[model samples]
Target: MESFIILIKLLCAHLCSDFILQTNEINNGKRKSGSKGLLFQFIHSITHAGIAYLFVADWCCWLIPSVIFISHFIIDVIKCKCYKDSLSTFLADQFLHIAIIAILWFSLYGDEIKLSYFESFCSVKVWLTIMAYLLMLRPSSIFLNLFLNKWTPTSPNTQSLPNAGQWIGYIERILILTFVLVNSFEGVGFLLAAKSVFRFGELSKAKEIRTTEYVLIGTFASFTIAILTGIAITRLF
Candidate 1:
């Protein structure tokens, strides 16, 4: 129970520091390859570490926050230098952050994380869940994007907000995956129906048959990937 409480506090600190505390200006600064960017990242990492330590409040466990701060800074720097605002980068960044937290948690509570606990963490169900989510997010998005790219409209519609389609596709796949995981297959049908109804006007007004077909293909492909991934997870687990 004490370890669980610590885990919750760490997660809260992560959420607060990463999303609540980080501002647009700071984020932008961190993305740039300059002194200012490094400064912003340093500040962010320090704040994150401070919040984490505040939650744990153990002087003997000082190394945990120190590790978190250093690892967080390095990961953020690498992400800033290597990737931009894309699904892969976003997922990778969050994964690294969570992985660091988990590592630190285990380190701080080494006695609690025995062989049995490690086995449970590495069990089939846990792996299946992780795989299902990964498929539903970046991997599925990449596959669907590539599959639809062949039919992409020559003159793309610039009126729509940037990355809106990508985000929508992600959400749709995640929901479908969730429904499948929970054995709520009926919910997937309802979700599809709702989406089609909402897109009815857009599809109807499409000037080109090619455009309409492209949208349909992309939509169905996204759903297919999600459904298959969910099925695989269910069967395997």
Candidate 2:
């Protein structure tokens, strides 16, 4: 229980420091390959380390916090150099951060770490959950994009940003999958209704029937894919 509490604290610190404490200027600075970027990264790493140290202050060990600072600095630098803001990069970044925290936790509580718990990660249920999530995101996006390509407008609208629809579709499917997995089927209806209400203005204002039909087809296809994926997760797990 103590180990779990410490783990949660470490996670909270990571989230707060990475997303909440880091401002837009810091984030943008870190993207540049210059002194400003390195300085912001250093500040970010120090803040993260400081937060974690506060959580384990009673332990009176500096090694763990030192390791965290160094590792986080390296990871952030590499991420800034190699990746931009996207679903895959975001997942990879968080995965690395969590992996570091897990390593630090095991180091501090080596006796509490069990082989059986690690082995559970290889179980079929875990793989199924991972597959369901992956299907909900990129795979579903690609499938829907292909299916709706025929209806895609030849003259692209300058008003909308590039890949906006794909991003929206990804978020919608993930939400639907969450609702289905939790057995809250009514949430799915609410989601659809909310989307319909939001899009109603655009549909009404658009003079072209093709645009309205296209949106409807895409929306339905996205929802259907998420619903089926959720059902599969429920049945398999």
Candidate 3:
């Protein structure tokens, strides 16, 4: 009963409320029009994270609530790609759609559950929790490209700032790096898919596989970091 309520609260509070509202703005093409409500923009950082959470929670067989925390971390990575540009609106849509999936999972799992709420509650240890999860979230390749752009060395041919074309090349490099880091050899399935999708953005078999790979990486990173940090804290304290 309580567990069901907790799931409900998570969907209503975090997934639906935040993710849906933000996604709508993008779909309606209001992001560039500059008329989106303040509330949507304020928490745009957390939109896509719900997808990663959904992926993990589904894998956990509906036994975990920690996915709520992880969702936000993943959202931040996706948000990194928007960076207050025209892409912001579409980014919101993608994130909210993922959240909706998570909500459906919550509903499908139903009322009763058996996990320890006490230990779950106790895992909220500020820096340890946030850092561990964010590490797992792995920022998006487009976002990584944006971050790298800030520090990319100037081209010898052009003394001025790097043009959009150069930045596009830089973005590709970052994507390649991201693919290498996330997929590895065991992730050959995802590597092929990611390579195709990044080369041509949008929904395709490759994009879906690549997205799944990213989710797995984030989930693994979050769980490993959280457990290791918990152990370290227990030993030290």
For every model shown, the clashing-pair count is 0, 0, 3
- What lDDT score goes with residue 119 in model 2? 44
Better of 2 and 3 by lDDT: 2
Clash count for candidate 3 is 3
Question: Could you tell me every candidate's TM-score relative to the true structure?
Answer: 0.58, 0.57, 0.24
Residue lDDT tens for model 2, 1-237: 445446656766676677657777988888888898899999989988998888656468787678889999999999999876665666777789889988888878756645454444334454455556666665576567667877898877799888888789989999999999899999999999999999999899987999999999999999999999899878854
* Candidate 3 or 1, higher lDDT: 1
TM-score, ranked from best to worst = 1, 2, 3
How much lDDT does each candidate structure score?
0.79, 0.79, 0.41
Q: Which regions of candidate 1 fall more than 4 Å away from where they truly are?
A: 1-23, 54-60, 82-95, 114-184, 207-237
C-alpha displacement of 201 in model 2, angstroms? Answer: 2.3
Highest TM-score scorer:
1
RMSD of 2: 7.9
lDDT of 1 by residue, 170-209 (tens): 8999999999989999999999999999989998998879
